[model samples]
Target: MHFVIERNRFVHDVQNVAKAVSSRTTIPILTGMKLVATNEGVTLTGSDSDISIETFIPVEEGDLQLVDIKQEGSIVLQARFFAEIVKKLPGEQIEISVLDQLSATIRSGASVFTLNGLDPEEYPRLPQLEEDLMFKLPQDMLKNIIRQTVFAVSTQETRPVLTGVNLEIENGELICTATDSRRLAMRTSTVERNDQELSFKNVVIPGKSLTELSRILEENDELIEIVVTENQILFKLGHTMFFSRLLDGKYPVTSSMIPTQSKTSFSVQTKSLLQTLERALLLSDGKNNVVTLKTLPDQQIEITSVSPEIGKVTEDLTTSEQEGEEMRISFNGKIVIDALKVIDSEKVNIMFTGAMSAFVLRPTDHKHYLHLFSPVRTY
Candidate 1:
């Protein structure tokens, strides 16, 4: 294989594909990246069994030439070394040629390096998914959904299903929910489906895979095509394709956990509440990280935290509106802070069924997202 390509574009594609390459992969050849040059363009692929990413660079775009193919061929190069070398190569263009016995030569301005290549035939083939069940979503909106819920996924391996975000689609609406038993985050959005009759449920995606997919997607209004199957999901962004394997177990039913009514409800400035909790968390017990919120007369609330070995913090915050029965609730300060950081509203509405029951937090301006937190029991 021989090709001369523009350095910057090549570097960008390499870094995107390298996100799937893992050094600890059980398959030896999976650590290397596969590069194939064809008549249309050059394709780069990387995978670590569970996830795979493939990107293509066309030969030319309008007036600018991206790649000049001298001969069409394929080879696999060590991902770690090849990625580092391509970034530091000092030149506007790079020329690569594969020699006999799977040896390759890389050349740039005044620099030449030889790397031993692996046979591309040994690399595992990516799944060829049919586009029967496909939908479209804006790139920026998809990124927001991942950010709003992926953090709440359980890190413990006790319940494997809770380590992923559950996705359900019906009647043109898509809902994403993630929880770690103590807290839950959910986001809902409308998607455009190719088939109006298409609907799916119980599709759970691993939190780690969604995080990596979000990192590669650019924030823009461009529509991304999503294809889902029984065991794999695919995200198509321009010339790049990302694939992830779905979790095997059934996700627990969470709808019944959300309360329809609240005994205590109040609206407060989101920033003020977030900042108060952050300050209180500094003096709270390290293990529990608990902070207490107690409603007072005249639409005011008190925030306090105390530690046996340290000092205590107390602050008074006036709510915009308060109603129902007055109550006091204690919860993990860190979890609330995480939810507040993702909210895009100036005012947040919170509701509680009782002092010990799970409370709900949501933006006053929209009903698209909701966060639920279970109170922490404190003596």
Candidate 2:
């Protein structure tokens, strides 16, 4: 295989694919990236079983020439070295050629590097996905959805299903939900489809894959195509393809966990509440990280956090509105702070069903996203 390519474009594509390479992969072959150069363009693939990312650079895109093919072939390059070498190449153009004996030569400007390349035939093939069940949504929208919910996925593998975000599509709406038992984050957005009756349910995508996919996608209004089968999901964005394995086992039915009524409710500036929670967290320790919220009859909300060894921290803010009753609730300060970070509204409304029940938090301006946090019991 031989090809001379635009250095910058090659570097960008390499970096993008490298995100899928896992350093701890048990399969040695999976650690390297597979590159195929054809008459059409060069395609680079990286995978670590759970997730695979493939990106293609056409020989010519519109009026731009991205790659010049000297010979059509395929080879696998050491991802660690190839990724690093591509970036530090000292020129605008890069030339790579592989010999029949399997040694590869890379040259750019005054720098020359020879690395042993592997036969591409040994690399695992990407999963074949049928396009029968597919939908489209804006890239930025999907990125936002992942950002808003992936954070809440369980970090512990005890409940593997909770380590992924559950994605469900119905009635033209796509919803993504993530929870770690103590807190949950849910975001919904509209999907575009030619078929009005298209719908799906219970597609759980690993949080790690969602986080990597979000990082791979740039902020854009361009639509992304999503294809789903029984156990895998594919995301197509421009010349890039992202594939993730769906987690096994059913995701817990989260709808029932959201409270239907509240004994105490209040609305306050989102930033103010977030800041107060952050300040209170300064005194929090361990898993408890507890913060107490006391609502005064005067409609002022007082927040406090205390540690046996450290000093207590407190803040008070006047609520814009209050209803139901004056109450006090304790919650894991860190979880609530993380939940607040995803809210994109100036004002946030929080509802408490009771001192011990799960409470709901959401932006007052948008009804599409909701966050729920289980309060910590503080006597």
**In model 2, what lDDT does residue 133 have?**
83
- Give the Å error, residue 91, model 2: 0.6
TM-score for each model? 0.98, 0.98
As for candidate 1, its clashing pairs are none
Model 2, runs deviating above 4 Å: none
lDDT values for all models? 0.94, 0.91
Query: Compared with the true structure, what per-residue lDDT tens digits does model 1 show for residues 1-379?
Result: 8999999999999999999999998898999999999978899999998899999999998899999999899999999999999999999999999986387899999999999999999989999999998999999999999999999999999998899999999899999999999999999999999899879989999999999999998889899999999999999999999999999998988999998898999999999999999999988666789999999999999999989789899999999779999899999999999999999999999999998899999999999999999999987
lDDT of 1: 0.94
Compute the lDDT of residue 156 as modeled in candidate 2. Answer: 99
For residue 376, give model 1's deviation from the true position in Å: 0.9
